[model samples]
Target: MCVNAGKDKESAQPPGCPVSRPVPAKPAQRPERVSLLSYLLRFRRDILSAQPARLYRAWMAEFRTPFFTSFLCNDPDLVNLVLTERPGDFPKSGRLFEALQPLLGHSIFITNGKEWERQRRIIDPAFESGRIREVFPAMWDAAVAAVGRLEPLADGRPIDIEPQTSHVALDVIFRALFSIPVEDRTASAVFDAFRAHQASRPMINTGSLLPLPRWVPRWRARKTKATARIIRGLIRQLVDERQADLDAGRAPDDLATRIMTTADPQDGSTFSPEEMADQVGIFLLAGHETSAAALAWALYLMALFPDWQARVAQEAEAVIDPGRIYFSTASKLKLARAVFRETMRLYPPVPMYLREAARAERFRARDVPRGAQIIVSPWHLHRHERIWRDPDGFDPTRWDTPEGRESSRRAYIPFSAGARVCPGSAFAMTEGQLILAMILRHYRVALAPGHTPVPVAQLTVRGRDGIRLTLTPRKTETP
Candidate 1:
């Protein structure tokens, strides 16, 4: 049975297509009228579903609050204006900062103003061009390890792939950052704690919508704090150990060493141990979780669209050398890169970026007030009805065309845009494309019969019930 059979049949392909393209999880239709309380309750389940259908076409939508107003912006120009042109006027929202404080503290992911700039100044060089290539081997090893882990799961039984991808992604971050695989006790503990923390918190900061004093004493659940502490403690241990290594002039030239030793040019200061822990927390959370989600969705999409999968596998066979996956060879996986890009478009890892107006400002002829929430929803813009042709459909080949390129320039922002854009965007693309190529080259993935991936935003976009698929070993000569 088609997973999206309930959707309009006209949008679906004619009969006898090799495989049915997977449609993203859509929100349940909203009642003609509903109270804000009811909507908020539903929103806790899935943000995408909580939205009204008209939002898919609307340029901007407003939600009123006793304390503050929030706007979801879908206009391409407006989005660019907020994210790129006037980012200083729209800082990261306080509600988001308060909600994430238990986990991220003052990590770069949440900070704004001069502090954000300082963190970025110190952290950016760690991911500079040369460093990405240096890290390629670690990413390659993790991809290969992931393939080995999945080999035993190719017996046709259903497999929940989210955990598997999470494991591999965690392994990648561990090895790349500290030169230690996730098998280490402390690393494993951090990974487990992170999972617990994510389970205990809402992916979206709905609390931001509530009008409460910034000092109202935000209440974090006990489990959330406990888990965050465990994760931070473990990260601190790693950072301290790396510090010792650096002091002894024995530190390996990995991401951790580089980040720790690279002082801020202006202040000539490094991340103190606690600060380092905070940065690592964001790195592990953002780096691994987002990539894991994207990879799982990419594989599921491949399973749903075998023709594209076959093309990817063929490209991998022709381009990727099994003996060694190098940085130079990564760009050769063009089809695989396209698949990753499209997957992000359909299910952006960080679905919506939340910011607040720093001062009263008018936008799109609407009155704005200080403290108003400004939501730039990549999820909505990527699939905006007025933007891309066949917005919801998966077409990897479209990326090569002029229209697709133009739309991407205007509307696509999976990693976001402007100066505050994710610094690790290039690293992530390499990791994602390489992993996808490696997996498709070795295994033929198919959606488990009677299973459909229900997308939900956890720390990042994930399958609510977990993505279930079957892996079959591919019998092909490695390039």
Candidate 2:
């Protein structure tokens, strides 16, 4: 689910289940001032821990690795320049394209310039704010399904929640996009293959560090490639079928239909099956994987901090009538939205955004050269010592304060910003809010005994051993 986590777990473990993503190295394993070779070695293990802790406080930090001269920019101004003000100057990095090429091909997520813009032009219509309300029923169904699935597991015992969240999130994406439940044969195949793919795709390959040309052959793991093919192949079949339905004028009015039917604004050209598949592939990943991460983390946050949980549950109870769900209800979930927002602040789904500096630029009086790897780390920025007060604390109410509003305006980008910002930003937020509120409304979550979740960023911010929480059905009306 993590689109890019640098390398992956080095194991030949069976790939049918949810992959236990990499955990952070113990402090003893991560010493200060390591050699470039050691850094690369450690990156393959856990990319975040490989860096010095000072990155949490530094405005701008530079790393001179052989692969590229890199700068991790925490300064708000620099982040704006790269992502918002002058995005063309800092397109997506080539390394990201290389990492995701196996699954995404040349989808908008990894492409840049005219091609990326064109894809956005065609794809954005389906995800516009007004269009999201149309998909609310699918999200609600997914949430209701989640409640049913958790009913059996709502005993006093502890269970890992990551898998459940992943399952429900994938279900939401499937229903919303293709109007098919995740249990549908083809949809199930894609989901199972993805669980298998996560184990194989420690994204970085032998060619990761090398300055190889696009034409050069890159090494990808045999299993990684195989799983990627299976996933994409299944998606291709899905889009092809959808295209046929569209031709016959019987396509379900879903996200896939809207995307495939909407011609590119500039060219007035529709996407071919292959192109639609490519976009859909990224959609499944971005939509499903990231949503799962947000939900899982929000649940864990509720478990660890019950006061906030109570507040959100009360809000959910007040806003949502378990009897029937309405799209308007999503707009009324204020506390749930705040909690989800806070969860992302503490653990950004895509931990970092990598952009290559197209031209040499100076930042905070430091020289930056063309070809430098520009890193905008939400993981660090959200908790930057110089930025937010009590930076590491989980306080959903922070979003309501005057200071919080100012800081959010300056910082707070769970989804990256500007022209290349996630087209589904609004959709993701509404989904996150509604689903989270719905879950807490039916069940109370608490931290599993002796199983504290340690935050680690991979594909998305995940617990070191998966988040284990104890679930109990709320005695009130069940939704």
Candidate 3:
């Protein structure tokens, strides 16, 4: 029987299944305003708080500045047009590159036109569906290791799960890419430096928003630059070592090896050592940080809804053998997968994606000038009042319903969509589901007393103070 099985249906909807769901901490209500200064100030605190509640219903909204015009698109059709149909006309904003250049340096995340195309061509094969299956064992090993680490920490004390998830995600990336665990000193150093770098940089810096002169110098704090240098140096070391291993014919067959050797089909060009470092930096940052944010929020949601957690645990026991998780068995974790998907809809990791118009375009009957900033916000679209029914509620079972299926097909884009969609989407989903199942199989998660997480957008959407939860060992009966 499920955790809510014994009570009347009305009373037993689910634990924490009030008429309303528990939303992460939101900013206090403020009077509406359109001033750029106000937006900048509010954005520094929380990106969600920076926008007006009206965006939840507006199909499209525009903001004009002395430097550039910006548009926020909420309509699904416009979103599809920008992301899928006419993506070529909307290149990644130069302002985004300016802000991230110190750390990312021409990475695929911030490139445009032919440069972006060439990089994707070389990188895409490493993330193909078949390649993901080849890499699943590494992910599984990391998930098992994470469960082992958590076992001793399941002592019913309030624990900040964000860092824990980050650790596990980094471990997974390292193992998948280099055939090494994060415990390796160079890997550990890069991980530590990344955390420091993220602390020093906001997701949307002023340079990306404000119109500043080209020579104004986008100021980066010394600490941020130092950390970026340290991170890049560590990655370069790994790349050099991998190159030496390849030359000697002893290289491990992993992501790094595959990427370094794959040449552009059109030109037979390969990534240079410096270029390889940039790509690795992005893979580590994007792959781990986003996955970490998703996992932490998912665990928090499981804690908030114990009945759902119980169902996930039961499913895990039925499908996953004790002390063993296999790539072949991942498809059996249906309930866990639904829970993970719902968590993403509520707390998308990369909350907003920014692009700039490459040429004049018309969207929703409005004239958009070339160089205008285009914002496609997954955060708003996921909870759009006009799109989602019970938009703020936590109901994983909705996956089984017609409305839920329709909404997912249309509005759900935790990984964004179209040509530039995240290549590792499949890998991320498999990893998240595996970790959720492994954790739930051995533990019951609950929120700490009086604890609430405030959602903030740094490089990824994360709890401002951190997500605190209590874990207790679960006693499972043999099937």
Candidate 4:
């Protein structure tokens, strides 16, 4: 289904400027073509390689697709051109967006065009740095609560950090987004329904990759419907409560209120209750899931590299003043931040991004026919051989300097990028650093005997079997 890059008759030629001269014939050029068989061979080659970065580079040297295709590129400039420079011409893929639609509905993350813009306007204000500052207390509270829960586990005992991080992040998201703890039975049910729905849906990497119909998967359809019911009921209750508060001329200055009050500048329209629920659903999923992935990965990395963990602990100890209890101190731990950045580089929460060409266009000198689905993987880019010096290595020190940050940005995209970038990136990073620093301050983690974290692609890049580690009391205990 490739479309040619030519104008239609209505826009063909203005009266007669170039009618006299025939267009010059150009020699046909092969655009790095790789047949389906060769493509899968390259895919397997890269997947099996010890150095995946080099393999990705080799894969990029050719094009491959049998049915519906995806162009996997590792070039930095080319990527920037696609994601940042001309994003309008390359919208998020319809297939991918539709797959997420069951869970996210028409939320900002899944929708494009004017609808996406409107949703973004309503929700973006709540994720501002100032808002994140307001929510720091909530995040610290969750981290402290998590640490308290883990204190009972003795040294040498295996601990699954994924559930712990998940719980902490879910608490943070609930408090930050709604100013209410997720302890209510109604709220718990909503989140439970969502998790069930996620599990029921088959593993579809991106929308375009799957050919299965929604009805063919009866369980998925049921879960989708159940998810909508749970979320809608929760949203209706919350909205009514907030509206009642507003009626009484008093409302908490929480995320809910902020979104309720935010109006589009151009049209000055507010989100309806249903629309607000959709936005809430998105933030709830995005906020918790992303932070959980980052925090868990950060801990896994720390466990694997004890020297760096110790260094981070020292940095955290030095920065945090006794009885201050401010999460803002997390920002001062430069090395800790570097470690978090490195972890994100290794296992970006949003590992892949998909876009569909708006119209036939040329990328670099290669022709990209319209309607082709383009796939870009942060998992591949962060480790792209040409982009990083030693791509596979866990080197936090690589992010210690200005040059390092620049280079990392060229390859690192845990939050994706451009207009569609994650709106809560600052909040996520701050929360991750604080949680990570707090964990380091409280415990010394080691790889549980016979255990190694194996990351796999899922709703996020998660440890397939769960990240198990041993917790030992830190040597430098505060008096």
Candidate 3 lDDT over residue span 370-419, tens digit each: 88999999998998889998887787888899998988888899988999
> After best superposition, candidate 4 residue 442: deviation in angstroms?
0.9
Per-residue accuracy of model 4 over 49-69 as CA lDDT, tens digit each: 212324346425323344465
User: Between 1 and 4, whose lDDT is larger?
Assistant: 1
**Steric overlap count per candidate:** 1, 2, 0, 1
> Which stretches of candidate 3 lie above 4 Å from their native place?
1-30, 213-215, 323-325, 476-479
User: Once model 4 is optimally superposed onto the true structure by TM-score, how far is the C-alpha of residue 311 displaced, in angstroms?
Assistant: 1.3
Error of 1 at 402 (Å): 1.2
Error of 3 at 68 (Å): 2.6
Ranked by TM-score, the better of candidates 3 and 4 is 3
Q: Relative to the unseen true structure, what is the C-alpha lDDT of residue 150 in candidate 4, on a scale of 0 to 100?
A: 76
TM-score of 2: 0.92
Best by lDDT: 3
Q: Following a full C-alpha superposition, what root-mean-square deviation does model 2 have from the true structure? A: 8.9
Better of 3 and 4 by lDDT: 3
Q: After superposition, how far is residue 287 of candidate 2 from its true place, in Å?
A: 0.7
Question: Which residue pairs of candidate 2 clash?
Answer: 2-459, 8-202
Q: Cα miss at 353, model 1 (Å)?
A: 0.3
